[model samples]
Target chain A: MTKKPLILVTNDDGISAPGIRTLISVMKTIGDVVVVAPDSAQSGMGHAITLNSTLYAEEVFMNDGPQKEFTCSGTPADCVKIAIREILDRKPDLCVSGINHGSNASINVIYSGTMSAAIEAGIEGIPAIGFSLLDYSWNANFEACKSYVKTITENVLKNGIPNGIVLNVNLPNIPETDIKGIKVCRQAKANWVEEFDKRKTPQGKDYYWLTGKFVNLDGGEDTDEWALENSYVSIVPTQFDLTAHHFIKDLNTWNLND
Target chain B: MTKKPLILVTNDDGISAPGIRTLISVMKTIGDVVVVAPDSAQSGMGHAITLNSTLYAEEVFMNDGPQKEFTCSGTPADCVKIAIREILDRKPDLCVSGINHGSNASINVIYSGTMSAAIEAGIEGIPAIGFSLLDYSWNANFEACKSYVKTITENVLKNGIPNGIVLNVNLPNIPETDIKGIKVCRQAKANWVEEFDKRKTPQGKDYYWLTGKFVNLDGGEDTDEWALENSYVSIVPTQFDLTAHHFIKDLNTWNLND
Candidate 1:
């Protein structure tokens, strides 16, 4: 018999989040699952690590699934770090994050704790994928997305991602069949037009809550935003290499010595 | 006579960090300066935001400089976010962050609060650059790197960074005469070999501090790391497009439907 892949699961949503529960349910069917996720929601945490405090983890039985689980008192990236360093006996074959409580499309991927955990795993040489639904509810409908999740996860395990790369997958909130299949697309050229909700504190100080309208300036139909809007599951093969290779030649012309 | 550019100055190392002070001094010679930085150190905070709490900012007088400064309680990225939204009267002609009290070269870029601030600016369609020194001490000599800082900042203002990119510039800790000039380079193939320093707490509970030795496995001399090691200012114009474009064709070969 072929050895089952060892899958490490985590999320920006808490360990008990409906999204993670559904993710765990799907992962358990494909592999020997070991789940290590945050004890509470950490939605927009990005890639933060808890350096200012102590960390502790506890084994918990959350469901009837055969997958063993643990709750960590840190960010989603922290859960992956602790799991890879202190929890797992061997390096996991795959690390999957989220089934996130919200969309991690376009510029949202940069601020996403969910995608950050997966990206962290990719940095550690583990093939990782972060899955997010367009719904940002505490209770999101993930039933129709399971089979597609299985197919993608299976493909990821079979083909594996390249060095320094991970997958950022976003599913639209639509009927399963109505989902017009998956598209391997690029990140849309987009940004959030931030509108800070400034308020006077009860103690008589001014403070602001960040609010924004996501603006997609790209007209390209082959982008992630286009794919999602058309009801196709969007998969953007993402990398941690931030170097803008194309601009090196231009920057080199600068006469810094002058 | 041409009006000097309006330069937006900020950092992750807090408004009073020696790095930001040096950056402000350098930017004064370039243009009109506005400083909006975190009120406290946000080391290792990568692209985090203030979603759970309200952000507060206040104008503060610190020493004699032409720049106007504000201290905010938020991450590096958040400072950039709010600066654009509520602080700046016009979109900044250039955004500059850090002559950081540490190295943000190679693999460290992913974990850098400094670069995240600059990347946040890049996402907002602004020309931005993040500067760092190889030194990581509060008393580290910024005086030694000032001339190069001025030169680079001027070059950036004179010739703008292209759309969809920002600069990650790391200066070596050597004397100006010994400096081997700036090099436009790629990030090296490096990985942090984390050696968690496990220890016992006061209650005898085992705890750990995340520490690591950086291992640069890439022997390519064209990388930023190689430039720095040779005592050169390494300028890597970083981009946010995370797509692994080369792998898209191979990924399409997968039998995803089955």
Candidate 2:
């Protein structure tokens, strides 16, 4: 028999969140599981790491699931770093992050802790995926996502991901039956139109809460936004490279040496 | 007479850091300058935004410079968001972030608050550039970089950056005479090999300092790493779209729908 794959599980919503708990239950049926996750919710952390401060991680018992777990005091990216460097006995075959509480589609991916963990794992050369439910509620039902998650995870394990690339999977909140299947897509051209809600402190000082409205600037039917809106799971293959290679020749033409 | 270009300035290093001070000076020579930066150091903050807490920004007098300055209680990305939304009287002609204390070349761009600020500005359709010096010290000499910064900033203003693209410029930490000319390049493949330094706290609980050695994996001469190593200022045209377009076809071939 083939050896079971070693799977590393993590999330941005802390180790004890129901999202991660559901994720852990799903992973256990597939492989030998180990979890290293933030001790508290690290939403909107992007690709942050704990550089200026020290990190604290300790093994914690939170579930009856067979997966070994450790709670970490750092960003989602840091959890992956420490897991690879300190916790895991050997390299994991697959590293999966989240059953995250909300959407990480389009421009939201740039500010997501869930995707950051998956991205960090990808940088370390592990096949990685980040799963998210469209619902942001604490009681968001993840049961409808289980079979679909299993199929995607199984496909990833069967056929390895390419270098420098990882999968970003976002599921619609509708029932599994209503879901229109998975669609391979590109990230939509979208952004949050920020509106600062200015308020006064008790001592007459001014403070602001960051708020925004999601705007889909791209009308493309082949985008992640379109997939999510039409009740389909979106699988956008994301890469770590930020370079705009096509524009290099144009930039080089500028008269800079003078 | 044409109006002087409006320039928005910010950095990962706090408002009072010598790096941003030098950046402010260079920008003032080019346009009508306005500075809004974090009140404290926000190194390694990545693309993080303030969502869970309140933000406080206050205008303050930092020096005898004529530019208006506001010290903000948020990350570098937040500074740009708040500036565009609440601070600036008009949309800036150009947005510049950092003469950062260290390099944001290659994979470092993914973890850079300096680049994040510039990227944030670029997302708002502002021409933007993030400048960094390789020297990671508070008092690193920035005089050698002044002329280059001016030239690059001028080029961006004269010839606007293409939509969805921003510049990530890293300078060699050498004397002016020793420096070669600037080279437009691609981000090299590089990553930090993390080594967690485990130690005991006062009460004997274990903690760790997240530390690492940067390992440059790519040796291509066209890469930013190679340019910086040869004492040339490197400019990588960076983008926020994370999709690996080349992999989309292969991903579509996956048995995901089943």
Candidate 3:
């Protein structure tokens, strides 16, 4: 008999969020689970680490779940780092982040705390996946997502992810039966068109609130945006390499030595 | 007669840091400059933006330099967004971030606030470059880098950066005469081996200070790490599209639905 795989679980949302609770419940059936997550919400943190200050992680009892849990005072990326470095006894078989409260589909992945955790784990050579729901509320229904999540997790364990890559999975906000299943896709060319809500404070100091509208510039059928829009779960294989290899020759032609 | 280019200058090291000050000086010589940077240090900010709070930007007099300056209460990415949306009179001809006090070579780009500003600008269809010195000190001499900075900025203006790409340039900490010119390279595969220094607070709470040693796993001669180590300025063409295009077909073969 094989030992149960030790799975590391985490999220951008605080340890107490409903989304993570749902994720924890699903993972408990699949592996020996250990969770280290932010003590408070760390949405939109990207790949930030706690470099300027100290970090604190205390083991806490959130529920009677079999999975060991720790609440960390750091970004999502830091949680993964501290868990692997100081908390865990050995390397994890897999790392899963989120079941995040919102979409991390296109350019949103660059600003996502949820994906950052997964990416951090991927960098550390762990097979990882970041899951997000299209719904962004405190009480978003994740009951419909449990079986699909389980299926994907099992498939990842069975078939290992290619080196330097992790899965960015986004599930549309619909009934699981209505879901058209998972589609392997590329990230869409999309961005948030920022609009600042400028205002003045009572002390007469001017301030602005960051707000944005999501815009999809790519019309291709093979993108994450299209899959999510058509009620399919999108699994985009994401990598940490920011290099644009194709453009190197062109850049080389520039007269730089002069 | 050619119009003077409009250049937007920013940094993760804050507006008052010597790094951005050096960048501003170089940029002023090339164009009509505008500086919008974070009011405080944001070293490990990555691609984060201020979402949960109000952002404030106040025009400040830093020096008698011709460039306009605004110190913002936000991350590096936020400075670019707010500049493009609320500050600048027109879309900038070029956006340059950093002259960062530390290296953003190899895998560090993923956690770099300096590169994030440049990537943010690239996403907005602007030709952008992020410059960093290997030296992490506040007093790292940037005197030797001025000519190289000007040359690279001019080349970007002359030969535009490809769409969906930006440059991550790292300079070695050596005298001007010792520098051996520039090399176009790929991001080396490297990561931090994290060390968490556990300590106790006065309240008897255990805390950790995050520290690490960077380990370069790739020995490729055509990598940014090699170039920087050899005392050459390294320029890696970076992109924001995180999609692992090569792995999509294999992911499609997974048993995701069943």
Best-first order by DockQ:
3, 2, 1
Error of 2 at B100 (Å): 0.6
What's the TM-score of each model vs. the native? 0.98, 0.99, 0.99
Query: Each candidate's DockQ score against the native complex?
Result: 0.72, 0.92, 0.93
What are the RMSDs of all candidates, in order? 1.3, 0.8, 0.8
- The better candidate by lDDT, 1 or 2, is 2
Put down candidate 1 lDDT per residue, A117-213, tens digits, no spaces.
9998998999999999999988789997798889999999888888888999999999887998999889998988889999998999999998988
lDDT of 3 by residue, B1-258 (tens): 899999999999998888889989999899999999999999999889889989999898987587789999999999999999999999999999999999999999999999999999999999999999999999999999899999999999999988899999999999999999999999999999999999999999899999989999899999999998998999999999999999998888887876
* Highest-scoring model, DockQ: 3
Worst 10 residues of 3 chain A by lDDT: A58-67
Q: Report how closely model 1 matches the true complex, as a DockQ value.
A: 0.72
Where is model 1 more than 4 Å wrong at Cα?
none
Model 3 fnat value: 0.94
Give candidate 1's error at residue A107 in angstroms: 1.3
- Per-prediction TM-score of chain B? 0.97, 0.99, 0.99
Cα lDDT computed for each candidate against the true fold: 0.88, 0.94, 0.94
How do the residues A1-258 of candidate 3 rate in per-residue lDDT, one tens digit apiece? Answer: 989999999999899988899999999999999999999999989999899999999899976587899999999999999999999999999999989999999999999999999999999999999999999998999988898889999999999987799999999999888998889999999999999999999999899999989999899999999999999999999999989999999989989986
